[model samples]
Target chain A: MLNELKNLISKEILLEWRQKYSFGGILLYVVSTVFVCFLSFKKIVDVPTWNALFWIIILFASVSAVAKSFIQESRGRLLYYYTIASPQSIILSKIIYNSFLVCFLSVLSLGVYSVMIGNPVQNLSMFFLTIILGSLGLSSVLTLVSAIASKAANNLTLMSVLSFPVIIPLLIILIKLSKNSIDGIGWSVNYRYFISLFSLDMIVIILAFLLFPYLWRD
Target chain B: MKHWWKFVAVLFVLYAIIAGFLMDVPALPILHETIRNLYFHVTMWMAMMVLMTISLIYSIRHLSGFKNEHDIVASEAANTGLLFGFMGLVTGMIWARFTWGTWWVADPKLNGAAITILIYLAYVVLRNSIDEEQKRAKVSAVYNIFSYIMLLVFLLVLPRMTDSLHPGNGGNPAFSTYDLDNNMRMVFYPAVIGWTLLGVWMMTLKIRIKKIKLKKGL
Candidate 1:
């Protein structure tokens, strides 16, 4: 199982490498959105707006990036995967790969956002930690939602519709944790948010693992 | 004989309507007469949550047993739940406008409730988009389970993380904490049960109609 998962993960990575435009397009998406925001505001905004806008940018970017995790695959390719890999490994690999993709994209966006808008984050490490946690949670959710939406003919609107509402809870926690980081709050104050984010990620991941087989079979 | 619970639902709701209006309520500062809405408005949400849980359970059963009957029950229950959710939202909005002087408040609890409704709306959208029967059932069942977890986290966990205008979350005092006098409790508990039973009855009727359609190939 471990070996199969590793192979699947590498396959996903290889597919991204070969199809560089898709991944590069996501990067370009982040940079352009940050630049657009920079143009709109034309001046550094308050900390609250800065934090909110940064996550909003990351949220849309990650949604576009992760929505393709399943939808981009042709029917023939999905059928091939169904025959070759177990559903558990398939979902796990997709989640892991998408998490890596989103985390990298979010961190890149964070850098670009800071450069363009001026960073208000007080605790850089903690902010990055929240970003990573947010990435995992978003990828876990969007991967499954992408799988579900793909079955309905890769409708992009359906992907957003299915994922946005489901992602709000995680988004709220992420924003709160990131806000605390901006305030440079102590760990005691921030730890519960961390636990909540982590637990939500685990719940999403476990739900995907158990439910993917049913989606896989049909 | 088997339909006795439906009779109970009717009686309880009738009692709630009469007593909820005529019964004396505590004289509160902001919510003087509007406190009676708790019996109707809050119970709509309670019924929604219960109906959605039933839908989630049927989705799980569909995944495990691959029974189309379970899928029917799941979808119908979700449909009925969405009706209750909409009612809850409208009622809450009216209450908020009266009490808080705004039709909308960006409170976490309010946003959570709205997001919960959107999640289920997406579920129904997902069902409609998929044309293949078996695939629709299986895929929607997967999405159903995924969204239910997300809904719980959104409605239950996320609200507590930040201060909210809604009672029972954060520092706000619950209606039950002080305002739900014995007079209110009698009507409140029965209102909850009555509405839930009523929603379930609607769901079962829809499910039966769906089952008949499936059997008739209509």
Candidate 2:
């Protein structure tokens, strides 16, 4: 299973490497959005505003990015994959790859956003932790929804509708944790947020692992 | 005796309606007489949760067995759950209007309620978007189970973490913490079961009707 997962993930990466423009497009998306925010906000001095705007940007970028993950796959390709790989490894690989993509996009956005909006985050490490968990949670849920929306033959709108409810709680936690970190709150006061975010990620990944096989069926 | 549970469900609801109003409540300051809404409003949510659970179970069963009946049951249960969820929302709004001096507030309870409603609505949308019978059932069932667990984490776990973050509490009463008086408990507990059974009854009715339509080749 582990070897299959690695092979599948590398296949995804190889595909992504061959399509450099797709990755570049997402990177440009993040930079352009932050530039737009910078133009509008001028310079956000409020910690809460900075935190909220940052997450919203990340959320939108992640959604658009993952919406393409499954929707773009051709039917013939999926059938070929179905024959060669276990559904669990297929989904696990997609999730792992998407998480990396979202994390990279988030980190890129954070740098641009802080430079443009002014860095107000007080505890950088805690903020980074929030970014990591937030990316994983968003990608896992969105990847599953992408597969779902693709199956339904509708793309962006359906993906958004299907993913919004599942993502809201996660978005809330990410915002809260980042808010705490922005205010330089200590770990003792913020451990619950950390624990809940971690558990939420675990639940999504586990559910995707279990449920994707059923979806794999034609 | 075949429909004995249905009879008991009606009995419990009637008892709750009569006793919930006439029974003495602890006359808290803002809640005042509106505490009576507790039986009706809160029970709607409890019932919705129960029906959603039923839907989730049927979804899992459908995945396991690939039976059309399980899919019908899962979809109808979600439909019934949405009905109860809307009822819960409207009733809560009315209660909140009188007590909170607004029809809506940025309360976590409202957030939780809204998300569940959206999730199920998305489930319905997902069902409608698919053209193939088996594919619709399989995909929506996977989605049904996926969203249910996400709902659980959001409603059950997120609140505790957010409670300290927002000490204002939005004037939202923590019923479990301070405790419900014995008198209210008498009606409240029964109301929970009564409405939940009523939801299940409606769901079964929907499933039967759907089966009939399918049989008629509709």
Q: What tens-digit string does per-residue lDDT give for candidate 2 at A55-145?
A: 8888889999888889998889988997899999899999999999999998898888867778888899998999899889999999999
Give each prediction's root-mean-square deviation over alpha carbons. Answer: 1.6, 2.4
Which window of 10 residues has the lowest lDDT sum in candidate 2 chain A? A113-122
Task: Return the lDDT, model 1, position A73.
Answer: 90
Question: lDDT (0-100) at residue A15 of candidate 2?
Answer: 89
**i-RMSD of all predictions:** 1.1, 0.7
Native contacts, share recovered per candidate: 0.97, 0.90
Task: Give candidate 2 regions above 4 Å deviation.
Answer: B164-182
Tell me the spans in candidate 1 whose CA falls farther than 4 Å from its real position: B170-173, B177-180
Residue A159's lDDT within candidate 2 is 96
Q: Cα lDDT for residue B209, model 2?
A: 91
Alpha carbon lDDT at A42, candidate 2:
99
**lDDT of model 1 at residue B58?**
92
